[model samples]
Target chain A: DVKVTQSSRYLVKRTGEKVFLECVQDMDHENMFWYRQDPGLGLRLIYFSYDVKMKEKGDIPEGYSVSREKKERFSLILESASTNQTSMYLCASSLSWGDLEQYFGPGTRLTVT
Target chain B: EDKVVQSPLSLVVHEGDTVTLNCSYEVTNFRSLLWYKQEKKAPTFLFMLTSSGIEKKSGRLSSILDKKELFSILNITATQTGDSAIYLCAVESAGAQKLVFGQGTRLTINP
Candidate 1:
């Protein structure tokens, strides 16, 4: 079975702090995605990488950046944390071209205060 | 802008009852529609429908899509408490490799 793992299951940060969320996949999938889930808003795409060193902005990429230095890993960076930035973050990976069904990692619930 | 919408934002019913969840979408160069079940944490894949009238089933859950109508429905029979969770609908469009998700429907099953 494919497994996607997130760096932190729960995190707490203060406003103005820099935050980093990491995701790793064992399947070596070529596509990875980052999304933030909020109440009543569902899951909104933040950013996605189709290959190593390649990144593209999703619908809601503001205040967020991504890095894909390696094929098996992807990172999400919050420039400066804010109370409104606190939410459940999910990481997913899938095979490129075909097999669009994404496999999700155990999400990280971040809290900013 | 591509958009997906789910109906009956919340539903509660007793065990063994049947329920149907609805999802509708408006996306240019439509690709496919997907359904996911999310509990407390991450959402899990349920079904991916690309063809119309072809129902996909897994035990008690079944889903079908209508390309002409641009809508889909997920039906769950013999509901269980374990089935209580948020059901999400998403759409994939051409040129957009990412999916557009709808505000999920919260379903609660009481035993």
Candidate 2:
């Protein structure tokens, strides 16, 4: 059984504030991803990390950045949060690029007011 | 660009009924197709289909992929109220680490 845990389940922040969402996986997976899910939009990738200090931008990477200083932890950062940034953020990790099964963490619902 | 589309955006069914969800994709360098069940929390893995015509089953839920048609179908038999959830279909492309996801089909099962 793989376990993926997020730092917060819900968060509220004022406009222009900085926000951080953290995710950690116990399976020692090499691939980690960040996605934002919205109604009618599905899950849009924000960012992904293949290895420590290696990051790649997904389809919707604007207004967001990610950090992967260690293999087990991945952090999503909103340099300056805005109301439009409010969304349900999800984190996932997979054993490898070819391994398609991605274990997801309970999402963090962020509210930017 | 890799695109995954799920049909019948939403469906309502009663207990003991059978439901089928459809997913179609147009992806470059196709690798595999996956199914997920999403409730209020995170999405859980259901099945992963790599070859065509091979049905993958787990209890009442089963799925089959069609590589030639670039599509897949998920079927649930004897559906129960607990089976209500958003069914998601995703495709992994070769040489890519991320999976392209569909908008998902929301299923509602009434007791």
Candidate 3:
């Protein structure tokens, strides 16, 4: 089974603070994605990386960025957190770009006050 | 714009009852349609349908897609309390690296 692990299960930060969320996959998948799950909106893609050091913006990428320094690790960074940024963040990894089955991490619940 | 829509935003039923969830999509260069079950955390993979007129089943849950209608249906028979979760439908389009997800159907099974 593919196991995706997020660095923090829950986090709280003040406004304007920078936040970092880390995700690691054990299967060494080549594709990684970051998304924010909000009420009634489901999961909206924030950013995705097809390979190390390569990143692409998704539907909702404002105030967020991503890094893929290694094949097994992907990171989501919030340049300036705000109250509106409080939501559940999910990380997923797949074998390739076209692989439809994306294994998701446990998710990080972020609270910005 | 590629869009995926799910009907009956929410539903509540007693255990052992049968339910059908609907998902419709309008996307270009269609690749596949996927179903996911989400509790309070990240969504879990359920089924993926790339071809129409074929049904995929697992235990009490089964799904079928229709390419002509551009829609899909997920049926859960003999529903259990554990089946209470948000059922999400996503569509993957060719040349697009991401999947377009529906708002989801929130199913609640009472015992």
Candidate 4:
């Protein structure tokens, strides 16, 4: 079984604060991703890392940045959190680009006031 | 931009009923399609379809892909309350590491 772990299951932050969401995978997967899920909007990709120090912007990457200093860990950074940024964050990992299956973490629900 | 669409955004059914969830995509360089069942927590992998007309089954849940039509369908028979969850469909593009997901179909099963 593959396991993807998020640092926090729930978080609260004030507007304009900085926030960090950490993710780690035990499967030694080469690809990791961050997504935000909203009602009626489904899950939208925020950022993804294919390898250490290599990152790419997904469909909605504004106000967010990611770090992949190591193969097992990926971090999502909210440089300036806002009320609108409150949502459910999910992290996923896959064995490779050609591997279609992605294992997701339990998710973190963030509230910004 | 790649697009994945699922029909019947929500459905309500009784136990022992059979249902079909639809997913269609218009993705460039299509490689595969995947189905996931998500409860209140993270989405769990259900099936992955890379070829057309081949069916993948797990207990009461089965799925088949139609690459030529750019669509896939997941069928669940003898549905139970445990089968109630948000069904998500995602497309994997060739040479890309990310999965583009559909809005998902929310299923509700009542005894």
- Cα lDDT tens digits for candidate 3, A1-113: 89999999999999999999999999979999998988788789999999999999999999999999999999999999999999999999999977979999999999999
Off by over 4 Å in 3: none
lDDT tens digits, residues A29-55, model 1?
Answer: 999999999989989999999999999
lDDT of each: 0.95, 0.95, 0.95, 0.95
Residues B31-110, candidate 1: write the lDDT tens digits. Answer: 98999999887789999999999999999999999999999999999999999999999999977888999999999999
Provide the interface RMSD of candidate 3 in angstroms, 1 decimal place.
1.1
RMSD of each: 0.8, 0.8, 0.8, 0.9
Find the candidate with the highest DockQ and give its number. Answer: 2
**lDDT per residue (tens digit) for residues B32-52 in model 3:** 999999987778999999999
Q: State chain A's TM-score for model 2.
A: 0.98
Quote model 2's TM-score: 0.98
Model 2 C-alpha lDDT per residue in residues B9-105, reported as the tens digit of each score:
9999999999999999999999899999999899999999999999999999999999999999999999999999999999999888789999999
Model 1: TM-score, first chain: 0.97
Residue pairs with backbone atoms closer than 3 Å in model 3 (clashes):
none
Q: List the residue pairs that clash in candidate 4.
A: none
Q: For candidate 1, report its TM-score.
A: 0.98
The runs of at least 3 residues in candidate 1 whose Cα sits more than 4 Å from the true structure, single-residue gaps closed, are none
Candidates 1 and 4 compared: the better one by DockQ is: 4
Candidate 2 chain A least-lDDT 10 residues: A94-103
Question: TM-score for every candidate vs. truth?
Answer: 0.98, 0.98, 0.98, 0.98
DockQ of 1: 0.78
